[model samples]
Target: MTQPNDGPPQGGFGAPQDPPPGGFGAPTPPPADPLGKQPPAASPIPPPPGGYGSPPTPPPPGGYGAPQAAPPGQPPQNPAYGYPQAPPPGQPPTQPGYGFPQGQQPPTQPGYGFPQAPPPGGPGMAPQQGYGYPTAPMQPQYPGPQQGGGKKFTTQMQIIVAAAVAVVLIVGGGIFYASSGSDEKGKQGEASSAGTGGEAKGGEGAGLDGGTEKAPADTKSKVGFQLPHPKVTDTTTVHGSWVTDKAYVKTGVYEIVGYDLAKGTKLWSVPLTGQLCAASRHMSKDYKTAIAFQDGKPSAEDKYPSCTQIGALDLATGKLMWSKSVTSAASGDEPIRFGEVTLSGTTVAAGGTSGGAAFNLANGAELWKPKADANNCYDMGYGGGDALAVVRKCGTYDNRQLTIQALNPSTGAPLSSYDMPPGVEYASIVSTKPLVVAADVGDTAGDGSSISDFFSIDAATGKLIVRISADADKYAGDCGSTEVEQCGSLAVGNNKLYVPTEEHDGGGEFGDTNEIVAFDLTTGKLVGGRADAGDDYTLTPLRMDGSNVIAYKQPPYDKGGQVVSIDGSTFEETVLMVNPDDEAIRDAETSFSFDYAEFIYEKGRLFISEKMVSEPRDPSNSLDDKQYLVVSFTTV
Candidate 1:
């Protein structure tokens, strides 16, 4: 089903562009390869004036990197972001916690989906001394269509359907679903304190903290280990991560490697003939998963071979159980190359332009294969988890139609299907069970975020539950333009959707702030409570910890990032781990761009890894650039 060859657009996909018309934070492009060789993503946002790496105006007490005792009688210098500073004389020192007291009224703030007067430096001014990059609207860079045969499809459209199968794998991969017997054993302590040396809070079951990893008596965390970026002549996809009680596994060049979970010691490696192209975000209950890879090693003449091989992998042992490809009359009976693969129950489902198919996870038994159709329909991709769902395409290229269906995990049969509204070219399945789908209806979001409305559907009945209109400029969530299951920075739980508000002016003169707010699934209206990120920190929903929401707070340049558990009912935050303010540690922790990186926080461990890796931008200083593949921190 090779579509006709349409011309590639100028600048190619992911090329950097001017900031969006208004200075709202734009959807960050996926990480580009080193330098400007591959399609370059927007520049690493400029650091705030006098931000990290700046000439210290007063030179934080002990300089940077490590903390030192304060001079006799002088106030503490560069207090870690969450801990409190000394209060004014006579005003009893406030508790040394990162957030306000429970039920305390939050101060009036701006940037809640509405406009307000710009801060001192005007809109989009980078924060001062913040730990992470602040987001603002940048011009959206939509990939142009690539025509083949007689059909035309946007590059991102192909990517949407093509990469859909990996959604569940990414979401469920080792972080959330990987089997860990020790998780339960670790969930015995109360929330950790804010300061590195402080005592733990004295409350039991205070909030539904995420994962079973018990917080340390002191909440401060130190670097566990950091893996350096592998040298690559060109951009390479290394987008897989998994965690187990004993090991932390990730994809590498032409192989998969497993390392000791707590210690970064290499344990095992599974070799492959070609590089990995896609990986399922979900892991099987038995510590198994699926992946797609090229058939042969790349060469100068044929750099990227067809991603025709699908295989099952045993994460515990780094074993690839099986590998094979499928064929359909749609491609004149030749082996069909797949773009994405996912696992649901005991079945492995993969989709591409040739159509879709499923196989038995345990034995590699073909349960179904693609078939040629008159309408030129094809299975674009699938979202697999609590259930299996597909985004099926139909009709001619000019008037394409799309249907989303919840499928029978074993048979590939549609149990229910919902037709997308007219003119909608692509849709992302945010969650399979609740049937939440996101789309940029009428292409109105205009921020390259690839989302405008979130449709909540009844998977059992294929009926719409509610349509939530998400104003792109005001919210921070990304259902990538190219994948149905590649949405991030948002979480769904407790029959509600949690999303971050775009960064806006904090009443303070030097920094910005944001909050995580929930929307009721049934009513599509704003929920009353919000978890504020405090000043100079950006909050994002990571996942659900039963009824609580696990979130990450991007730190201001001088401080370290934080992970917290927000009570779903009260929206109160419990500090889980506050990274040390050691300058070197802060830099390493924030190096991975949140936009294209994968963060798995389980059992007091925060693993930040890149989905793509590239050679150093300055080859001459390749040895000094110090690029990183994975940077891990833990509180245990």
Candidate 2:
């Protein structure tokens, strides 16, 4: 999910520029050989059939003629081809020859028939020395060109040609090996980039952000380890949420941090150029990229009070991929706020006071913007998958009417629009397939108090299916209060709606008990009899763990909290581990407003974080001392 940047093209070796006009002007001549005469036009004798020097042949038989018998008192007579015999007493050894000498051995010299010294300073003549023999006197010069000299020159040339061929082969092999290695590295990079869709396909080492070490598998229980509280300052508010099944992300005013869920280790942290006003709301399927909105500096003249921008970042590396302004002319004194940042298929979208706009996920280039007439739309929220839900405000504030519209998430084109009943206002979206909406229709007593109603409508046709009244339904008593906003969070799973009842006063400092109510999505009827969790606990539905509904208790800071698992069909409750009775843990929980403590569920694991008071409270505090304690529990 790397967003393309508009810059110079990346990666490639420049093609060898066509050898300048006339091909490097003509190749230079080869250097002259310094050790011998130039080679002949052609070799006089053909190479041996076996190539190069032929294998050696057998030596003459009878040992080159039987050894001659020696005289009575003398050493055995030296025969031809025998080891050279030292001259009688004090004389030098005889020079060796290929065949027997005519009468007596030739004068002792360095070589048998070759010159023993360099020739006089002539034009092209020089003394010759046999291979491995030392220099000595010159030999008699021949009348014409020496036949042996030509053969020697030819032999040297053959050796030179073989050496040149070997050099070329070595250089060519090195280049080929280097190119093959580069190709393999490129293929691996491409494969990793392709897996950034909905499913990440490799083990821990697969998606490392930069060169960070891979985290070990998450096997330790919740009680085995605890993460230290994150650091924050008084001026900045810290928010935490899950970005992927194995990673959780935290955002502050100017920084975003990521952590490994299994080990609770900090993976990476990125600082932003502007103040981050919104936490990450949209993440690419592969969890490689995330979208966040930032509030830019206000205009100098204060004509345009608020400036906003949307940006994308690499999840693994914390690299800022791209950012662009998504602002329009202001119509009121209040600053603009972006309600939703989401991903629809391959498109990234952001909705604000001026309607919504969609951008290409690969480049961050705006693809489409909402129509001018749709400027009245606000409070945009994503409806599950690809449906963009918004509220269209019409008329004055006191006599205003709100209309709910489902738009194409990518194009911002309206698919269905329904005007809410006279006294009703949209509260939240419970489902997307059939478009279930929870609306707060005015109080039953007509005193402007709250009375909630659930509406399930067809998304394609805007046809109403069922309207369940909160006060009249059989399970109405299960809802602690008539106000829809105070009924806790709503979760839909296994074709049923799970809702947490508000904490009720039982003559205690804090509410003692609350129950979780389940209703069939299609029939609008209770799934089972009321199931009370117990005293001193409030259960809020978080997510589904296999076939069971997972919820957690939000106990008072002094009392500890625990995670619960309820059977989706039977509504039976099972208490997981309760928080340790540690004073530090209780103080951390009480440090922040109860709302700041967040519990997130993903891939059968529950993540919880509590803000920590690192230093003593001071109203004029300037030091950045805010922090949070994080931990995880396995639900499956």
Candidate 3:
């Protein structure tokens, strides 16, 4: 998942793990603090009240933009910006915020559902035994010294799926999505159309519309503005962000706030009934997206409410557009809580452990509701945007069958379905148009990135094109284990898949670097073009800009980060926006984990934001570390 340092190995849904050493995007300590001095320690501040709508809570000492220090006698807790800080010796490891469980380490080889300790071998060593899955041996395109014996691994992950189902049944009949057919009757709500929610207040600025500001002839950028992190007592989640030509929109505690794109001044806010729980990564051409939130505010007894409300947000103009939810027959007609939401054309789709449902984007009308049947099949999740696709699970838990389907967005009908190979407990859709899917078949992707192979399929024919074996330890690409479309560090465009090689030794002393390589989707062969990240830097493909690949470069400890546009055919990079190397600005810029952070770059401006926030690691040694919600830079 593109960690910046050699931190703990990520396991399960808890804190993400670090990959093996010296590969693309490997974690290494940053250069010495640019401030050239330690921050003075301060007394801890009491946490704010519990529940939603609480005022912004400050973070622990030594936080970005604040005075930094560890308590006296406690070893310095300073860590590279954005990477999770490990607690001092003997103290419990730091816990990630937002409902992620603590203390579970990633399995040695890939295993779905439950996590077990790595089999006896040390890091980079292959697991001694397979967890009842078959193995397929293969070769790498650019072979190098890496973990495993160059043999691609897959596991019988269905066994763990069975375990999950049994646990759900035992735990008070929890939400277990098994659909044989469409049986649930959707409860129609009053039609709420786009822009129904009132417009947000605008700041004293002009050009409030879509499109980017003009770029400077010289691409070097300076600090545009920064938004302070909202003070949060608990580990709160601020999960969504978007940019319209006119404003920068972000999800706050119980509201969505829009700010002046270049000035960072508040322009508008759409307050919600509860905290935002899920957001779509893709935005429509009209700057519309989908989101999910709790129905009610959190109380003392029920601190975290179910994410049941689904809504479409208009980014150009601050509006809720429409908010609604559906009932699941499997859940006794209760509102089906969703874990993810996405937008495809005019369709808004939501899915979770209970099942999945779709709605009209213009008006919150039910398009379809999941149904129960003999086969016990359900739509696990979907990948949206250019096209609509779904990862459907069917059959018994012990012999669960996963299929990737290209669907008709308007009718929610499958246009084509490609059956996944066995032993894949979970699958993620990397792209819907090309219908590329990734899975840790046999749990062989030991790096915990949940990717071992990329299945390039013919969406129209529902036939396999090629299986690109991307050993997790060698490539930096990662896809969410459960979420259908959450993938990063790679991009698919121009009939090719572009992924970065693991970080390795660079030419200069004390320098490490990597490159982005392309693979032909049809033939599954290396395209022989590589875009190198110069010494002490790592390049990750962010997205496709026409035929060009826009990438972000995580710089060395002493340098500022950079955004570059690489020509697809030539593999040549053109500097788009280069952040300043000033000490203060550098710290602020680098304080984002490549994997977990949200990066938006357009028209010579780059914005970095966090998806999660929490209190200080050592609450007792709290300092007024100036934390920020977002840091922006521009070359205009």
Cα lDDT tens digits, model 1, 187-241, are 2212121100000001111224344544579899989888888888766778778
Off by over 4 Å in 3: 1-215, 616-625
Give each model's whole-structure lDDT. Answer: 0.61, 0.41, 0.61
* Ordered list by TM-score, greatest first: 1, 3, 2
Clashes of 3: 33
lDDT of 3 at 84: 37
Q: What residue runs in model 2 are displaced by over 4 Å at the alpha carbon?
A: 1-235, 243-246, 280-282, 288-290, 295-307, 327-337, 374-381, 384-387, 396-399, 443-451, 471-488, 505-511, 556-559, 589-594, 602-605, 610-636
Tens-place lDDT digits, model 3, residues 415-509? 98889877676788877766678886655454445676777877887877666666454466766655666777777777777787655444453
Please tell me which predicted candidate would have the highest TM-score against the true structure: 1
Q: Which one wins on lDDT?
A: 1
Order of the predicted models by lDDT, top scorer first: 1, 3, 2
* Cα lDDT of model 2 by residue, 1-636, tens digit: 110121111110110111101111111222231112122212212121122111112112221112234468875433322224457988756543221222353433343323345446765764553221211111111111111001011111222332342232111110000011122112221111011000100011112222211112432223423565544432332433555654677664456778776666778877775445343333566664434444432234431112245666667566667777654333233223343455545666655434456677667887765443322344333443334455554543345465666667656676887666665432445455435566545322110112245655556666554454332111111111111112224555555555554333222322334566765545554554434545445556654554465566655535555656677677777655455446555444333333335566454455666422233344366553334456555533
- Report the C-alpha displacement of residue 32, candidate 1, in angstroms: 36
